[model samples]
Structures are given as structure tokens and as C-alpha cells.
Target: MGKLTATFLKEIILLARDRSGILVLFLMPAVLVVVVSLVQENVLKTAGETGIRVLFIDHDRQSTGQVIEELLSGSGAVEIVKDVDGHEIDEETARTLLAKGDFQFCIIIPKGVTDGVKKRVEQQITEALNAGNEAQNEPVPLPSLAVYFDPLVQGAFRASVVNVLHRVVLSMEMEMKARALSNMIPVRMNLILQEIMGPNLINVPVGIFPRMDSKWGSERLLDVKIEPASRGGVEELPTSVQQNVPAWALFGMFFIVVPLGGSLIREKQDGTMLRLLTLPVPHVTLLSGKVIAYVLVCTVQFSIILLVGRFVLPIWGMPVLEMGSSPAAIVLVVVSAALAAAGYGVMLGTIFRTYEQASMFGPVSVVIAAAVGGVMVPVYVMPEFMQKISNYSPLAWGLNALIDIFVRQGGIRSVLPEILYLLSFFAGAMLIAWGVFIRRGRTGG
Candidate 1:
């Protein structure tokens, strides 16, 4: 057998002999997956139960203002705050609060609304009479009521407010009309004012029609989109079987190369590497074997998670298989993850002086990778700046590719660029690890 092949076989044998290392690399990921999934589910459920908070600002101190407040408060959906600790809220305070997202909506009632509505109705009546004359038809004007509301409210809530305001205005108009008709005498004299030294009442009618238009000073609601999802659209993996399965799976795959890289560091630290220089086995063969062993461990760990996710959890990721190109995409995700994890392990092993340090750093590196790559939080829900930063991490590419396969139902071609990027990341990380290891050997550092 080739020296490299023999070295790889020896590494695999060594790994099989270490039962504790085998469990850490294999069983831990399954546990992590379960824990993360449960936490996500609970958070999502809680968020859904509590509706958004909104505030009401009543500017009009009149009866109409009271009616508006009553209408809004009557709905169990809203909470009305008339004063904040004995201090009245102003427009500026409302704006500041809204900008901070303290409240989803705010209602503002302009002063003189009742007076404005009355004047507007009179003006509409006069306009109707003129229009009637031009059309040679009897004038029947409608009330032109004005209802003003702030434009910074949410769309759904604003629409509800408008509907309630229309009802109140209609009631006011009906009451005014009833009082005016009741005061009209049986024989109303249209020319009473003419004979009494005035001709202003010559065309006066017993009852005048009020000119009313549904909208006079209404404004559109604020346009804001809020995502009310837990993990902001991140998929839920099953947590019943494993507490930190996903985290472990990701880290386990990554740590597979640690031992391979650790071997060189160990030899240097023990002074055995120099003593072994007299042997026939080449240095390149020893490194090759270690890398191969890491690949094998990563492959096994990945396969176990896939089987558990499929059969045990019954959790089917996006049906990429139906796309006829999912197989290629799946292959790409697995290969990329394996390569990147191996490279990461190698680098950690090379940098650390002892096996304990390499082991500790392995999990730490996985956490950092998950954080930057969006394993903890979804990239889409993250702030725009964070999404930009995530692009630099290999975990981001791997997770994205996996999400495409599971959530977006993207085919192989759709994720080709991501796969290529991951591959490049793996190659780059591996190159760095190789360089560090070789340099350490040469410098005896």
C-alpha cells in the first residue's frame, strides 16, 4: 500500500480505539440539535400569543374626542393611555415613540373638528345650490363633514378608525337634522324676512340639506413592515432526541481534522518528530493519512445526522429531491461541510500545543463559525450589515446552501455558486492549515 494510504488507515485505527473521542464527535451533535429545536419552538409560540402594542393620542378635548377615545378603547385589541404619569403627550413625543417602535400605531384628533365639520357642511350646501341652478334641477346638498386623523398609524388599525369615525359623524348629522326639522313651523314663510325689512330669506327652505363628503381631511396610514417570527424564519429541527444536535453536528464534522493536525503538533512538542526523521516513512505520507482519517470521520457523522433527521425525527427538509437536482445540491452541501470542517480541525490542531488545547479550541471554532455563518440566527432576518458580514464565513455559505435545499426548495443549479464558494473556502482554510503545520515543523516552534 502507498505510504499515504497506510498512514490514513493507521489514523482511522487510532480513532476507533479512542471510545471517548468517538462519542464526542458523533453523539454530541445529536443532543445539541434537540435542545436548539425546543428552544426555538417555545419562543415562536410565545411571540404569537402577544399582539403588537399601539398608543392613542386624543387632541380634541370635546365630546367628539371622548367618543373617539371610547371607540378605540372599546376594542380589546388596543390599550389606551390618556396621560403618561400626569403629563399630556404631544405630537413630537408621539413621533419619537413611534420611531423607537414603542407603539405600532398612534391616533391623533385635531382640535376644532366639530366646528370644522359644521362649517364644512354649510359650505357644501351652498355649493350644491349653485350646482343645482347650473343644472336647472332642485338643489339637494349633502353634509361635507371633515374628520382628520394622523397619517402615521398602521394601515389595518387606521382603516378600523376610519370606519368608527364615519359612524360617529353620521350620528351627529342625523341629530342636527332632527333638531332643525322639529323647530320648523307648520306654515313656514319663505318671504317672512322680505316683509320684515330683509330679502335674505326669500329663498329660504324649512329644512336645509347638509352637504357631506365621506373624506375631507383624512390621511393615509404609515407604511411599515414588521416580521413577527421567532428566529425570523429559521427552520425548526427536532429537539426531542438531541439537545444540541445541529450545533454538535456542525462542530463534530469540523473537529474531525483536529487529530490529523494534532499529530504533527504532538510530535513537535514531544521531540519525537526529529527522532523519527531517520525512519523511511516520509513526512508528506504521515500528513496525508491524517487528513484522510478526518474525511472519514466527517463523512460518518454527516451520514448519521442525515439518517436521524430523515427517519428518527421524520423531519423532511425542503423537498429538494422533487426538483430532480436536489441530489447534486445535497452532495455539494455535504462535501463542502466536510472539507471546511477538516481544514478547521487541522488549523486548530496545528496552532495548539497540547491535545487538551486542540480539543477545547475545536468547539470554540465551531461556535464562531456558527455565529458568523448564521447557524444561530437566520441571515435573512439579521440586520443588513450583519448579512454583509456573514458572507465572509464558510458556515454562512454552507447553511445557506442547506436552507436552499430544505426551505427554498432550490435545485442543484440554483445553489451552484454557493457550493463553489464553500469549496473555495475549504481549499483556502486547508491551505492555511497546511502552511502553518509545515512551517511549525521546519522552525521547530
Candidate 2:
């Protein structure tokens, strides 16, 4: 234990003395998080607050079209704006606007919409009243509302507009029915009364349809009930920070490979390994001390990066990092991730033959792994094929576990899978390093 402690302290001192490496460890990820967060600020807006810009072309100069326009304008989910430079635009121009991303969607209310709706409603009611007494009327085709959506808009936004349009259609149909009934009911009642009373009784008041009116109130034609589910207690960070902070931090953490491999190569070249082997301590003790020291180095590295995200970045006009509900679980995640990174560095050190080889291979491997792991782009935004392959990257698992804690407000159980995967990577890497050492021992090289 004393020897291990001495070796650990020596590793710490050597790592601290390297000023340039320490700078890169802390500087790169901070710059990335700040730059990327500033650039993608709009994409990280909260749900229901996204103001989708829409172009409304009301061709039907009638009440129904005007009502639909009013409905969309009032829906808070979207913003209805005049075309570029406040110029009036037609359907073709609106389509062009949608293509240019000036508008998220285009709504075209076709001509004769009011006439078409009334026509359909009258035909349906007449057919219903006279069913079996005469041949049914053929269904009238109503004019369709043309909706052109930009392919860039999310499907959820498009679906929301579609739902609103459905409500408009239902409201239009009901308005036409109410008008038809208001005019037809009095005439039909008078006819029936004259037939029953020899056309001589006092005429019933024209407004006596109140009895039926009370039974069929047309105020709310569609009753939409929403049963909302309970949400989590924690407030999450913007999507960008939630994704980028840990992602780039993991990228930086794995960069420990450079110094770790370089350290091994430098010691081997100085005949330090031979000298250590001649000491009383077992080979595992030396390896354990090296891994332990670097793991602590990695832990400090991660904590510094996290502190930048939590405290420093916010001062630079960026979102502050939310450490989540379970700081203990966060500690576990950090320690495990650091262990995996350290083990990977050890494996790289054993595999490479020289300082140049270890230096070149270490950073290059980290870049490839970080790229595949979604440090550059979010896994959610990646193509399906890329997302499928992302699981192979250990950095991806490390970032995922961090996200579980940070964004999902998850406890240890939620991140257990990711923790286990990182531990597996650490175990596998250490075994390979051990195997390489055993091979070197047998060959006496």
C-alpha cells in the first residue's frame, strides 16, 4: 500500500508538471460547448413554444375561410406573417417561400369553399330526412384546403396544423347545418300544423322552435378532452448543452490517452520498466498504481470541465449545467467513465511501440471514436445507420450515462446499463493490457 501510494503521488506530480497537456484537457471542450451552444440556440427551444412561421392564402373571400384564418392566427403554436418585405403573395409564391424556408408551411383556402360546404351539408341533411321514402342524394364533394409544408419542418408541427384544420372543417359543416335548420324548421312545422288543423287554427309563432333549440345547442360541436400526464420534478437544460457538454467532455477525457501512452513509452525508453520489475512489488501493483493515478487525473479533468459547464459557461451568456437530482450517481458515473478512459489509455500504451506511435495513434483513435459516438453531432439527429453503429463507441455510452443523470434526472438505476457497459470496456481493456504484459514476460523482451 505504501509503495502504491508513492507511485500514485509520483504519477500525479508528473501529470501536473505538463502545462500544455493540462491546458488542452481543459480548454478544448469549453470552447466547443460555448461555440456550439451559441450557434444552435434556436434549435434548443422548449416544446410548445416553437413559433412555426406559416403563410396563409385565403382564396375564399367568405366567412368560413375567414374563420379558418382567424383560428390559425390565434393558435399560439404558429405565427402568421406577411410574405417577404410585406408583399402580397399568391399560391405559387407561397410555395416558393416554403421552399426557401421563409415559411414552415403554406395554407391555401381554395375558391368557393363556403358554397361547397353548404352544398354538402344540405345534401346530407336532405338525404337523411327523406331516407327510404325516396332515392338518397349522391354525396357532394367539398372544396379541399391545400396545405403545403416545408420538408424541413418537423412532422409534429405539420401534424398539429392538420389537427387544427380538421377542427375548422367540422366547425364549417356544423355552421352550414345550423343555418339550414334555422330556415327549414319553421316552414316544416307550419305545414304539419295546417294539415292537422284544417288550416284554420291560430298560426303558431315563427320563433316557437325554442323547444328543439334547447335540445340541440350548437355552441360546442367538438368536445376535445385532454388528460395530461404528470411530469418530472427537474427542469432540463437546453437540448444542445444536454447533448454537447458530456459529449465533448467524454471526447476530452479519452484524450488522456496521449499523455498516458506517452508516459508509458517514455518510461520504457528510460529503462524504468526494467528497474521497476527488479523491485519487490508484483507487476499488478505497478499497473494498478498507474491506472489509479490516471483515473484520479481523469476525475479531476472531468470535474473541471463540468465546473466550466455549471458555473463558468453561464457567465459567458450560455446555459448553466444542471447536475441533476442525484449528485452521488453523477459521482459514480464520472468515476466509472474515468476508469474506462484510463484502462483504454493503458491498453493503447501496451499496443504501441514508441512515443511517436502512441502519440499519433492515441489522439487519432479518440477522434474516430468521438466522431462515431456523436460528440460532433447528436445521435438523435444522425441517420438511422449511424445511430445503429453509435452503440459501438464507448464514449457514446459514457455520454449517454451523463445525459441520463443531467437531462433525464435519472437515479442510479436509470444509468445502470451505461455504467455496466463502461465497466465492461474497462475490464476488457485491462485484460488486454495484462495479456500483453504476460506475453512480454514469457518472451523476456
The CA lDDT of each predicted structure is: 0.60, 0.77
46-137 in candidate 2: lDDT tens per residue?
22546666788877889877777776666666666656686887988988878988777787878898888778777776766656677876
Candidate 1 Cα errors over 4 Å, as ranges:
49-248, 257-263, 271-282, 314-325, 356-361, 381-385, 442-445
Model 2, C-alpha of 226: deviation from truth (Å)? 7.5
Clashing pairs in 2: none
**Residue 413 alpha-carbon offset, candidate 2, angstroms:** 6.7
Which ten contiguous residues of candidate 2 have the minimum total lDDT? 209-218
